[model samples]
Target chain A: MFFNISRYLGRFKLVGCVVRNFLILLVGLVFSVNALANPNLGLPPLNIPADNPQTAEKIALGKRLFNDKHFSADGTISCASCHQEDKAFTDGLPVAVGINGQAGTRNTPTLINAAFFETLFLDGRASSLEAQVLGPMLNPIEHGLQDQQVIVDLIRQDRSYTEAFRKAFAIKVDEINISHVTKAIASFERTLISGDSLFDRHLFGRDHTALSSSAERGLTIFKNKGNCVTCHEISWNNALFTDNRFYNIGVGFKQLTPVLDKFIAFVRQGNNPDYFPLTAVQRSELGRFNVTKNLADIGKFKTPTLRNIALTAPYMHDGSMKTLEEVIDHYDIGGDQNRFIDSKIFPLHLTTQEKQDLVAFMQALTSSKSPNHPTGE
Target chain B: MFFNISRYLGRFKLVGCVVRNFLILLVGLVFSVNALANPNLGLPPLNIPADNPQTAEKIALGKRLFNDKHFSADGTISCASCHQEDKAFTDGLPVAVGINGQAGTRNTPTLINAAFFETLFLDGRASSLEAQVLGPMLNPIEHGLQDQQVIVDLIRQDRSYTEAFRKAFAIKVDEINISHVTKAIASFERTLISGDSLFDRHLFGRDHTALSSSAERGLTIFKNKGNCVTCHEISWNNALFTDNRFYNIGVGFKQLTPVLDKFIAFVRQGNNPDYFPLTAVQRSELGRFNVTKNLADIGKFKTPTLRNIALTAPYMHDGSMKTLEEVIDHYDIGGDQNRFIDSKIFPLHLTTQEKQDLVAFMQALTSSKSPNHPTGE
Candidate 1:
């Protein structure tokens, strides 16, 4: 009877072990499913606009509209033409090339992880992705649509588009408008979250071996001696590589002050800033000043994310630096001297090895598989 | 004794069947392996330059070199910038956008399966890929390299390149030159042959069910009613979709004839035609006339292969047409009127359905996997 009791206890213990293992497996599957939902980057929940929720139909319609040239007045430029997937969604040019090959003053910023930004464009004039959409579409130098009505009319004419619009937005054909267009594109853009970079693996993934010694050294320099973390922040859980704040590093500062003065005078004259041509706004190089009209924000541009920095070369506001080495060298020399230059812009006497390491670290920040990349899944 | 005799006869028959099967297997293996050796495109043996034989080291070096921006004057543009792998080696621009946003006259042509071409470039001025490499690199409007020495010097500076050159060509560090650069690039380009479309699978792989029913009907139209086979040659064994010949389709005829006359005059004045800049040559729109200077060759561009044609859009030498519909429409009307137009080019009175069928057939010619496309393998 003692032997039988002992045997029963052993079977109970075995069953307990099986139940425990099954629970662990269930937990792992749940964790993996959650991970799959947010983003590969392992960042906090994405900043999805409340008005525009993501849907499959919306994304599909947005992709089609993005590729269609008929959206432009000249029927030559599509959004994809400039925001090319292969080039990390930025045209590889010093300035943004637009309708009839007319160039804008500012560099075409990468759309990768743009959903996280507090504002859009170098000047931070636009508050939301929706507001930014029409700025380019109707800009004289960009898509050059005569008006928003042109796009609406084109959509109305297409039976397929009408069906797509109705399905995506639950609206009638006549109700198809810019709100739907921007909402769809914004939804699509939000999905372009390039995460799971080797750097992310090293930190959040708890994989110490993910980074090479060179990349490790670079990370140290970026955080500590480099002082890049001040602007391009690293939070406890994630690294966005952008503080989403504005500062002047002395690039085009001297020239921009005069333009800022002119802009201020124009504002005093009761001129609506919206009427300004993109070229005029570009010429101002006013940066954050355009948004607030504050003197302190003069010559200050938003800090761009260092993610996928390798793919989107010709860095900074005007795209003056063609190589990472050039950008590093610019920082090392404490930037070009100007009155508006931020106090934080100081020289870094980095060793050659440190510079190489820093560049390597930045490169490591690049995603293992950029979702919107040409060859990416 | 009777049972043994019958068994021996049965064994002999079995052995005979085995031998015949083995022979068939050997032949099939040899055929498949040979097909794999060159490219998926069912073409004749590629015309590899004797001086620039393909090597793993050379191809690797070439790929890096193709992507290196330092090869350009401004250190911004790379060969791969305009000839992007995502867009089948052609930039999406109507005309090639080069260094400092300098636009070229002709459309950026695909480097895919260019190993089979008798000539390179839209005008066929360059006879070999090796010869073609320097044209773009040194063109003021393209890579903007001041001279061939710039490329040679850039390679010499890089330690990795010095080692790569030695392994590729058994050359000393000092021996690195333009010839080596072109040889390496050309060798790499030769490997980019994307074939194996559904059409190819049907024709070569003997997969009858590979093509959609619509595509099959389109193929019949392409061969018969469409008469695309006249220039885009369709042989029983293979379909190159190019006759390896030139023909005038009335594009740039009047303007080119005047320029051709001036070129003749310029040649008469002791100016070596070869000395003209690519921009000048491109401006002429002389087509094959630039190479041979023959009156019959005027306004005659080389017939480009239809392989992966779907990806390399903004078609034609000038890139005037943006869509497949526009291209088909041009052909349906037997091209615009010109004195030098190919006699074989005549009106195809295709119904809307037939036109759609023909377009579908041409699209079927596109590779299943564009070798150089960003999304492709």
Candidate 2:
């Protein structure tokens, strides 16, 4: 009897140990999963290239260079000329007018939250913001800089610029090249992120009062019936508002003519086929195809985050849509029917009340008012 | 000698009193000016319309209605379809998609900071968010609700909804109408205002390190070289980043056709113009003109604040420009030659460095990361 009792105690002890181990393992898994989903509700930090580290001095020097309009062929346009802060870093125009009154095919994108973008440009031609920084400097339709030497010379001419370069990069004035300029600008770009939206408050902050019942319902529809989550995935915790993927919902491709296709092909190569030089038409397409050169990518564009959608209007890569209602209508129709339409395109068949609820929910995503600092020191 | 001394003391006393009063007056003036320039950034306790005081019950009911996919024609989409919480209450698309795969014309604007907007929509068509909320519901391309009664019937049929309505508004479930729906949704929307960008930190919080040197330069350029301040007026203290005015920067008017002129004329009639349905072309031309009915407002649109321009891209009223660089190029040329161009449109001669600096500065305008509190509760 004593031997049996001792055996029973030992068995009990084993079971207790097993239960404790299981609890520990479960806790570990939860933590690991949380760590994996490093959700940033707004823009993520800009990814600076390994070759270039961001320094205060370089960023300052780059900023000075950016505000100067001498970079353009006509010497009448600076990067700031269009990317105005008051206009949300955009020129507030339907289409961009380039050097010498040259009109570009697309509208300017705001630099706000640009740091988080995987590929830059409407067509995603540039893989990095640094690469994107230099595109307009040389584009004949844009700043129209004569060459990299012009930028180098301009920086060399300014003593303040030279000193700034030295302070930022520890490089001699002559060594401050286009790559460094782009790098510095890119570093600054990393700082642009807007996170504090009401939606964030509602979801992550657990502020039940932050969202109204209508908005809460709208959120449910977005996640379920609307099928918006399929493309614009709302991660486990953080909601960046974008999946950062590319899709073609058929905006510009109404009737793909052979000529248009050929032009697209030429532009898809981007500036230099050997190196990739995008033509006007190809540049017009905008998004993934410009970067990948895959036929499947035709009319495909990168999915942008919807952090401040209410402020921006005339939506789409082409800016064809006029209002949010119109945009909703287009989506209801499953996008323009084109040969290369994304498989995700399907009719939502929402009701009028449901649409209103969705709009209501969207309006609830805005940020609350807070204090503001003075603009100048 | 005693008389002389007494006289001198008397004079001194009088002078002191005069100086003290003057100083007090000056202080008062300064305080008043400061108040005018920089009012409290916090919004007044969200003005739940008198007819629809927000209640936990009403909000909950609204949430249910918003999420109900049954509101859609096909029962596949709900109010949340286009506006997802994780995506800052906007579907991460250049334009919103709606029922039956109907593509929307405008990009889904983020609800963040929406409470501050004086006007709603890209064209400023809706005067208030409440009015705007109902727009998508009736649109064929969006939810396509069969009738307003459908909403009422749904709420009436559901026991939970009926109880919720009673608890929230002290109204019978039958009383839940379109007006009540919009008011509830608008109340929720009033909560969506973000005011915590790095710029905000530097400006309001006195965190000098919040912005990089590039961003500082960009601010300077934005105020000066970029000439952005002309349209995007910076409040002396708080920076909502908008002037809330309308201007035509030569958007969407290459050469005004008769149809365009007629539309412009129609818009010039101001609010409550001859009520008539517009053709699609006329609708396209009806930007700010639709709101004000002034010829000068032709092709003009309400100025959007530059709070989160980075996140909501494919910039401008028409999402025409793709990059900030392209936008700058447009301003460099003062837009395409047009009749309605704002006097503000003038070539800005900036250098490459300046442009880069401007881009850097604009990038700084983005908000920083923070905990999202969706529920204010």
Candidate 3:
């Protein structure tokens, strides 16, 4: 699933720096099940909204629609474009490329355990999966759709979709609204939940042999001096590797420092934050501030799950780093001096061996049971 | 599956008539298998090229590559764009649209029983599926790639493609060539043979009740007064429903008649047939003339497979006929007067009942076994 992140960079001239926001999150599993080697433990029951309960028809229909590109303006670019099944559902680019190669600011975050996240997206602009699924389709530079009707119209064009819509939503194809479409896609995304990692086995299954010596040492460092378990929380009984909280760990925050003063002043003036004419990059760097007008939340981003950390490379909200080693190195130096940096991030003077061990431990967090596992494990 | 063919026209400002060629041929089945309901008759032994034999690994790799958009220049369209499985490999559009909404000049023919076809594409420009798979990737208006290396470079960028390529071809990632990619795709395509239609059951299994009364009457009309059996050859045994030949049915040729002399003179002066300056529409009308330099080949196109005629509509080269009724009516009028029209296409003077029966018979050509079957039977 490894793709050349650099190839995408120099292939086209910078298109005004529309960064893909790759905000990933993890919640310690919902259940305290005993099959820990099966990270399947601690997985909280999926939150199915009351209106849209899970059904086989909706999930199956959603899978088809997710892979279909006709819904896009140019009949190209589907949801699977940036969110590939392999690579833990993240396209391995520094930033995501959209319809007509519209580049965005941020990495594609893994949706492996997205079912547990409180909010959706790096900016937290969307609150639920149903709401989140349709946002990109309408974004001018994302799917480049003229209107939401583009999807509805496209869905109604094919009899298969018509039948599928009827079976899933109990509505005629033309009668299907954006809500039905998003609900179906959300159902499919819910099924992408991954569990049963090697680390989970070592911790919960009481399997002494599950973790390699290097990975075991990495796990210790992750919990102790590494300080990774705090935000990427590892509870006594479960390890989702994220506290599901927002933190500005100093990547894009430094870039926004210069723009911060004016942006905050604009927000104070009681104007809609989205009305600002910032470049996609600048808007993306706003992080949680866009969601909440609080000045203290300026550079905060959702703490992403590290469950499949090894597979999702070019890490962070901006996908600035290309490997786990680069990520560890960034954090090793406490990230580069940003004013709004989270207190959780600090310089850890780890040796080269310790870095390798930590990376190994993160690698061990990848689910072996998931079909779309990066290695196809 | 049903698509509103008329909706594409008159809905948008007519886009300069880049009609997709719809050259259909029916190959009578090569097999005489007794299990008419088995859905396996009429399928000829898959013609795996000696150079590119079928293997499980190759088929799997090809399937992935077939669905992958990365191979396209813009990372958008793939082979599946116009050849969706559900539409019997046709996109249900009158003409095929490619990347950037660039439309082509021929109806998407079904690949359901393509393994048994003698040549690939309406113009017969490609001799085999191996040759056909790569044609779209490089066509400026198709996949819109600048070079074949774009696909190769794209394939090597992903670890899954690299691993799959190695396992399928016994070649390392960097060592991969374009031939390996095409071979794999062709192998997968060879497996798209569909059979066991109600027609097959009625014909081969001696099941009189397999077809509706209307369909049975339509089958008689097809063989008798309709005169469809000549071009769409129906053998006593297998029902591939094609003679694997070329014909000019006077659809686009009537439009090209004025330009015919100039085109012929251009070819007479030793111009490359394929390099002729024509819009996608003009080039498509040239048809088999592009393959063979013979003057008689002007407007001639290969006879396409009719295994899933019902699923792939907006029938004929240029997709002029939206329904099977339109096709029957066209032959009823002996097509528009073109000097180059195939002698096989003659006016049938069919009654209203006969026309309805013919349409019903064509509908019965659909197979119930394919996963993507329109009926999902």
| Per-residue C-alpha lDDT of model 2 across residues B1-377, encoded as one tens digit per residue | 63454455556798856666666687779865653333233222233456656566656666666677877777777767876655555665656778888876566666666777777876778877788877777777788887777767777888976776677677886677777777666766655566656666566656688678888777777765566764564542356676566667766565345555565455556535446455543455556766666554567777777765665555666556666787778887778766566545666777898888877776665544312322221
Stretches of candidate 2 exceeding 4 Å from the true structure: A1-50, A255-279, A364-377, B1-377
DockQ of each: 0.00, 0.01, 0.00
lDDT values for all models: 0.77, 0.65, 0.77
| Candidate 1 per-residue lDDT over residues B92-123, each given as its tens digit | 87888888999887888888888888888887
Range of the 10 consecutive residues with the lowest summed lDDT in candidate 1 chain B: B368-377
lDDT of 1: 0.77
Ranking 2 against 3 by lDDT, winner:
3
Docking level for model 2: incorrect
Give the Cα RMSD of candidate 2: 30.8
- Report the lDDT tens digits of candidate 1 across residue range A169-248: 99999899878888887788887777777788787776788789999999877865565765786654566778677888
Higher-scoring candidate on lDDT, 1 or 2: 1
Tens digit per residue, CA lDDT, model 2, A90-209: 676666677898877776776767777777777777878888888888888889877878888888898987888788888997688877788887777665555556667677666677
Instruction: Give one digit per residue, the lDDT tens place, for model 3 in A120-225.
Output: 8986778788989888888776788898877887778888888999999899766888888999999999888877788877776667898899999997777555
Q: Which residue pairs does candidate 1 place in steric collision? A: A374-B374, A374-B375, B86-B374
